[model samples]
Target: MTGGPATDEATEPYRRRIAEIWSAALGTPVTDAGHHFFAGGGDSFQAALATATVRREWGLEITVQLLIDHPVLGDFSERVARCVDER
Candidate 1:
């Protein structure tokens, strides 16, 4: 198994990308580490849009449920790391 610790280089870009998507979709500056997508007035439709945007931007397959399951930037970054490891 190649699964191990993810370095900052690998995680930082993902976090930034996620933050950009959230900020653009919500029209708010999400500069915090504890921002919640759904709790911040992000509906299912908006989440779906985010999923598509992430896929297009990162070329990674992510479902809306996955986005819902991991709302915060930190958790979503972990998920992206796991997906990269899996691939």
Candidate 2:
């Protein structure tokens, strides 16, 4: 957390993967796993796309609200990982 780039560098692979999906779905550049989805000008439609992306990527059927609750890529990845673990 010292250097800004270092923080992003420390992002988990899953978070990085999800961040890529989010950027593609939202048509914006999202390089940080700690980014807030809605604050980045994302809407419900984009959230849906992101949710579907996650499903395709991890085979996890999660709601858009899950993304809403999780917002950041790292937290979202954690939530999805927990859901997968629960099953």
Candidate 3:
């Protein structure tokens, strides 16, 4: 997260917000956008909770499987942003 610039301006906010949500859900500071969720102590239950939080916060329907599909925080953030834009 620190070493590289965010993928773009559109995704940076999503990335930061997701990192905060995932950090709380995972009980660890998820500062690195490239870090894998599962590798950062995330599980299915936590993923569900995190996505639920995202839904509540953004009013977006992000499936938990999206996180499973894109485990990397950066990729996940990009997808989430796309989802938001799509809606």
Candidate 4:
């Protein structure tokens, strides 16, 4: 996954996009990347929806385990971008 302060600038937009996804799926505003999806009332079913949405929107495959592991938006978005890059 992309790392360091340099990526922060690039990841800012990704953070916004991910926050939007979280807000839409969880039905709550998620302004911070540190926010936890599960803590915000997101379950595995919602995570599946999120995975599907990401797949459809970005054309990149994301596993549910990834979401489970990276519940934080910043970490999850970094993983998503890594998967996209690898593919």
Candidate 2: worst 10 consecutive residues by lDDT?
1-10
* TM-score of every candidate: 0.81, 0.79, 0.89, 0.87
lDDT, candidate 3, 3-42, per-residue tens = 3454477789999999999999999999887889998889
TM-score of the candidate numbered 2? 0.79
Candidate 4, residue 48: lDDT: 87
Among these predictions, the greatest lDDT belongs to 3
Q: List the residue pairs that clash in candidate 3.
A: none
Candidate 3 residue 60 Cα shift, in angstroms, is 1.2
Superposition-based RMSD of candidate 3 using all C-alpha atoms, in angstroms: 3.7
Clashing pairs in 4: none
Look at candidate 2 and tell me the lDDT of residue 72.
79
Pairs with steric clashes in candidate 1: none
Clashes per candidate, residues 3 or more apart or on different chains: 0, 0, 0, 0
Candidate 2: global Cα-lDDT? 0.79
lDDT of each: 0.79, 0.79, 0.88, 0.83
**What is the C-alpha lDDT profile of model 4 across 1-87, one tens digit per residue?**
447887777677767888888889998899987888898899998898887887887788677888899999988877777677688
**Deviation (Å) of 52 in candidate 2:** 0.7
lDDT (Cα, tens digit) per residue for candidate 2, span 1-87: 243554444446677788888899889988875789999989999999989988887788678989888897777866776677677
Q: Give the TM-score of candidate 1.
A: 0.81
Q: Between candidates 2 and 3, which one is better according to lDDT? A: 3
